[model samples]
Target: MITAEGLTKRFADKTAVDDVSFTVQPGRVTGFLGPNGAGKSTTMRMIVGLDRPTAGRTTVNGAEYGRHRAPLTEVGVLLDAKAVHTGRTARSHLRAMAATHGIPNSRVDEVIDITGIGSVAGKRAGKFSLGMGQRLGIAAALLGDPHTLILDEPVNGLDPEGVRWVRQFVRHAASEGRTVLLSSHLMSEMAQTADHVIVLGRGKVLADADLGDLVRAWTTLGVRVRSPRAAELAAAIAGPAVEIVTTSPETLDVVGVPAARIGDLAAERGIPIHELTPTTGSLEDAYLALTGESVEYHSKEIA
Candidate 1:
């Protein structure tokens, strides 16, 4: 598990990370999400001791990451896939990292196969594609078989297949009781992979909760109803607190009412209902709603 308490970082005139606190529990995949310049990268750097926190503390497992006897065995981190030496081969890079912690050549070979980079293991890092570089970085992280994994944008340059592989890999790791903290801009994939999420904005903790609860809290619950008597159904459900939007001649999008209630109302009125589907909010919806004001860079809509 990873724990941070009042973690803060300042770079000269600006605060890169404000007082932030969150726990990444074991046996579950926790997603780290934020917009650009939200201090997510800075926070991750502080967690692994790449940058010293100006205040508070962060611990991997039970102590500071640097204090671990074998840091690699305790935590595996991949903040930047392109941090490898450009002159070295993929295999050589992994071999060097493993050698630092006395990890054997056999384990290095295993990670190469595990990350599906065996074909490119002998190729120079400089010549590898973006996807290949990411694979090599992941292989190095898994070299020590650590108890905790911290990955930032692991799927940044991956293809569809590689993206799916990462989703499954993190889920499998968590199932085995390993702590996994993942950062990604892909909300759809994060929604499918993470059990919980910690959101940061402007270097401060904006929200932290289970993924389902976060979505429900930040977005409206609605039910999509399709019926020939859509207008009548909308009128029936209309109230001071309820909202009904007409999407089509035969369909209505409803809020402040449950699907069962809508179905019951339709049945009572003898209205023919073709479809009554409950539509819940998604992670993307929640993220946007929660971080709307926290966004540092805004792009105007194009005509």
Candidate 2:
């Protein structure tokens, strides 16, 4: 539903986004992930016509976002939940946004109710909590009932319940063939919410693939073995794929190899094995491995 070709954006001498290209397809939630200075917000802003790209361009459907007669109806964006006027009531905020597209007052109430902000509809937005404010922003975004949603760090202040709600919300929207592009730096949250993941580093695309098959690095995919003779077991398969980091005298933190092989080696050498377990990799590990040298700000003391 959304496509970008060689999209580039510059600020002064620094390139915020550099020849980045990707697509957000319909019927799935695509995650846009990167480090703090990795141009995620800039890319999102460009997609919604908030910021102009220095080179190349992106299109929602077949036309540039600016060319769309009803942009609000084409794409619903929640770039900044706090961008609302504090003096206005929640309902008033929705009414004002709906007015832009000439949507009726009843539609405003529909979105307000859909976002579960009916009780706070009359309350001043300045007095609302962060989660409540986020709901209000989502209400505005949904007011248009757009087919595409571009949300940047949407779950920032949401509680666990609200977070779950947002996740299901996106999934439900995508299930109906809508396109969703979500940006977040939180690896765990993205792991849970995104169907397809795009990893970015230093204003460039690092990895863009399905969330189901994150690169092997993201997950060490190792097996753990607890044998009585840990020393003998370590000596048998002492290769690059097998590393026995010391945790305790009786236990070894084995990584990079399968548990079955470890068990086979142990049984062959008469080493008694006690425990075998498989360990999965985390999104952080995968992201770090993918962008190890491409990070903009590396710690001089270590990395």
- Residues 1-303 of candidate 1: C-alpha lDDT, one tens digit per residue: 999999999999899899999999999999999999999999999999999999989999999988999999999999999999999999899889988999999999999999999888998999989998999989988989999999999998999999999999999999999999999999999999999999999999999999999999999889999999999989888899888889999999999999999999999999999999999888999999999999999999999
| Clash-forming residue pairs, model 2 | 218-286, 219-281
Provide the clashing-pair count of each candidate structure. 0, 2
**lDDT of candidate 2 over 1-303, digit per residue (tens):** 999899999999999899999999999999998877888889988988889999999999778999999988999999999899899999988898889899999999998888888998999998999899889888888888899999888888889988889999999999999999998777888888889988878789988899868746466676666777878888887897666776667677787667888888888888998988887777777877777777777666965
Q: If scored against the real structure, what TM-score would every candidate get?
A: 0.95, 0.90
- C-alpha positional error of residue 121 in candidate 2 after TM-score superposition, expressed in Å: 1.6
Among these predicted structures, which one has the highest TM-score?
Answer: 1
